[model samples]
Target: MWEATLPSSRHYQIFGYPRVQTPPPLNKRRVCLRFACPSDLQSRLTMRRRASLRTLLAACLAVHVGCYVVERGDTRVNNHVLREQNLVLEERAENSVHSLIKVTESTSTTIPAPQCVLPPGMAEEIQGYQEVVDRVIDYVTTGDFKGQVYSHLANLVDTFGPRMTGTGELEAAIDWMVEQSIAENLDNVHTEDVQVPHWVRNNESAWMTLPRLKQLHIMGLGSSVGTPPQGITADVLVVKSFDELKKQGLKAAGKIVVFNPTWESYGVTVQYRSQGASEAAKVGAVAALVVSITPFSIASPHTGQQYYSVENKIPVASVTLEDAAMMERMQARGQNITVKLIMGAKNYPDTISRNTVAEILGTHQPKETVLVSGHLDSWDVTQGAMDDGGGMMMSWAALVVMRKLNIRPRRTVRAVLWTGEEQGLHGGIEYFKRHQHDHEQFQLIMESDSGTFTPQGISFSGTPEATCIMEEVLKLFHRINATQLTNPMTGGPDIAVWEKLGVPTGERHLARGLYYSYLTNLLHILNELFFYVFLALHY
Candidate 1:
């Protein structure tokens, strides 16, 4: 039998056997114990004692476990402090992520204005022309030319309603423009041949039948195909942009994809119109429909060109805001919807068109030219009154005004009305090719195509020195409220060819907000002064 002892207190021990000898301590105040056997009978007694010792050991272990539990309670307090620190760090990280997302969203939509730099001799030139600026304004305000301008615009819109490329109305509009140019008495009036594509939209309509049946006003996008004569009817899958569509993958197959991206400006919003169809088709979608982006919602569907890759092609179209809203509501209800599309839309072989050019020849440097231009073509939806007709008229008026002012610019000013700008820059590209050899002869090219708004200022393309010179020229227009000068010309579609060919370019600044609303009143005064100034300077 084996017996053991352990310390119980400073002067006591937990004994496994009676009279167990105590061992010497290795260090002062330390205690130890030892076991010894005397005879067989005593050894038997020791065995009995050992059994009792087992019971005591079990009791001791229980006591130790109880003390350890108290120690564990203290450790739990330390763990609580660490947990609270982790929670605070997590909250701060979440806030930072939200702030970054907001900043990224805001910057994506804003349009930045170009920088302006002034040139030497600008002050003197502006001072010399102060009276001329006042006279120009008086001539515009007092003149009753507003009626005539309105009449011209009304005639254009009435004669050509929704004239998409390749339509007879589009050709008629071009012819009418040429007649106007010839009537203006400008020199070198003629047209340069160009080829354009024709796309037609047939009968098309959309509706939500399951959640609620309601007719939707929609128009087929340019270059889209007609549904089978019977039309395609299917469930709709809505996506915010192309990325979301990709994530849906095969789930979108055989369904109509609705793209509902919002855009603050036409420049940024236009991407969905141009690429939504192709992207949807790549994922096996049968068709795609995008919400119209225009702020003015008159139930008028705007149509523009949509590109198709050879491998992925699908029918595409646009719906007015009101109609898009109805579709969204129905989709949210988990009800299936169907659309009827009858697009007579088809692509024809490219056909012939032309870019019109007219000029005011210079006396000393007849070969050197200063160019002014605007595109003649427009989308088929609206009257195109503000888009380019106003630009064309304004440029034409400028030439006449220069003559009236008797200000013969050192270089001859040439005016061009471009065609096929809606498709690709076809007219401009062709012009560059034909006139590439004489590019160096061009001193400057100015364009007006943004909109028929009030005069704002001008932007220039040239050496930094030349841009400064142009800015100085703009100071003369300050009295008329067009004083801002932007660096790096916002070249027009018609004049882009010259710019790309390395010819210097500039764009007239026009007010954007109120100009489109009162274009007629502005044009009349502008036309009157233009011819008066042009003749005075040149003749």
Candidate 2:
């Protein structure tokens, strides 16, 4: 009923298409395949004069797969022929073998392949942690460390404006955290040395030249290359999305391609900032300009990391919403829009950075760890407060609260403030390399790199059993109304290293897409309280 083919590396040609019985010479062997049907059916399988069968059926697969060597004409290609009983999708046919039969020098004809492929009913084991969860919620909400997250974060922001990776100020911030961890009587406070990228931004500017001499507001994407000494002045080629750029790629050569994607979720829209430059350069674009990633902008341009395609590393930066929109409008009116981009950004040799580690040793299982982390480094635009500051301080505050209450989990609760997470996962990767051999001891790896927005639940990936246990733990947070576990389908970059190594991982799933506003509104009471519950649930 359907047609499928095996790989060329095999020595068989199976086909169900153009089904017909073809006559063969007596000199060659013709196998008569008679089906025991309601009526009767027959098929002729022609073989060579020597019609010798050769195939490693055991080498293919053991169980139900019916390995066959069917040669059509002189073609020795490998193909899969459908069985007479039922029709199956070609893709799913190879995985599931319904019948166990093979075609040898004898008469036999049968092939079958079959393919094999949710949430919170809280377990009783998790039901036992109710008392401990309640105490954690109370301590974070109304106890001694009630409002200290803000004060601590404020001091961190005021002390170090932007803790970008490979910077002196960032190292000082790590040192301060180390001293503070030791001051809190947390045991085994130290740092893990790692190398991180260093890209400095200075004198970055953009100006509209062809349409008018209007200055444009711009922010260079992290790791973007700087324009030459004289700057890059070229006509602007505006495109709404990557698709449009691809359609009109011929017009992009030697021009500055501008991406002005409409307001969508950050996950959908930030592609321009992350990959616009490399994509544009592929089409011969001399440089790329992306409209700020924010859905709503008050004349401010947002900047994030942009990776370069080694073949053509071009300059890339973000322009304010107002300017990018205006440029698009001018282009629609058939006006020739041109702009000059000047970036003094420079990349230095990789420098050393430290991941600050402070732990509260467990009372029973000291070797096993419930690891909580947040990136300490940030983009060099502002004080880097909300993006990760809130997450980092919240992580540190959890450790501080447990220490203050003289409480410890069954496993070691370790708070790791990772460095160089913004540029890439430099510090996190190095830390993983150092402790990958000890993956078994890592009971859980948790990170909240996203803004500590109104807590919905945990973003997690693990076995079904693990998911059931975590859902039961989430139910314990019903009092605070922040208990829903969802998978971060597209996100979870920070802890990707451990997730691949089969370690159980969790990231805070916030009500994202309001990052531009959430950064300024730092007094989120629920966001702060949910963190404590998250920490306790993992233990």
Top-scoring candidate (TM-score): 2
Residue-level lDDT of model 1, residues 187-265, one tens digit each, is 7878888877776665667765655566767877877877777677778887766667888878789998888764333
Q: Each prediction's TM-score against the native?
A: 0.70, 0.75
- Checking candidate 2 for backbone clashes, the offending pairs are 5-79, 6-78, 6-79, 96-113, 96-114, 97-114
Candidate 2: stretches off by over 4 Å: 1-125, 488-490, 516-527, 532-539
Report how far off residue 232 is in candidate 1 (Å): 1.5
True-structure lDDT of candidate 1: 0.56
Model 2 C-alpha lDDT per residue in residues 1-539, reported as the tens digit of each score? 11122323323333221111122222322322222211111223332222122211111111122323233331211211222111111111332312223332324344532222223433555676788778877877787667788778878878987888878889999999998898999989999999999999988898999878999999999999999988999999999777689989899999999999764445445668989999999899988999987657787888888887667899999988899999999999999998999999999999999999999888788898888888888777667777688888888888888777667677899999989987878878898889999999988888877676677667566655565556667778888766755432124456667876778888775555355444332434333456544454445
Name the TM-score of candidate 1.
0.70
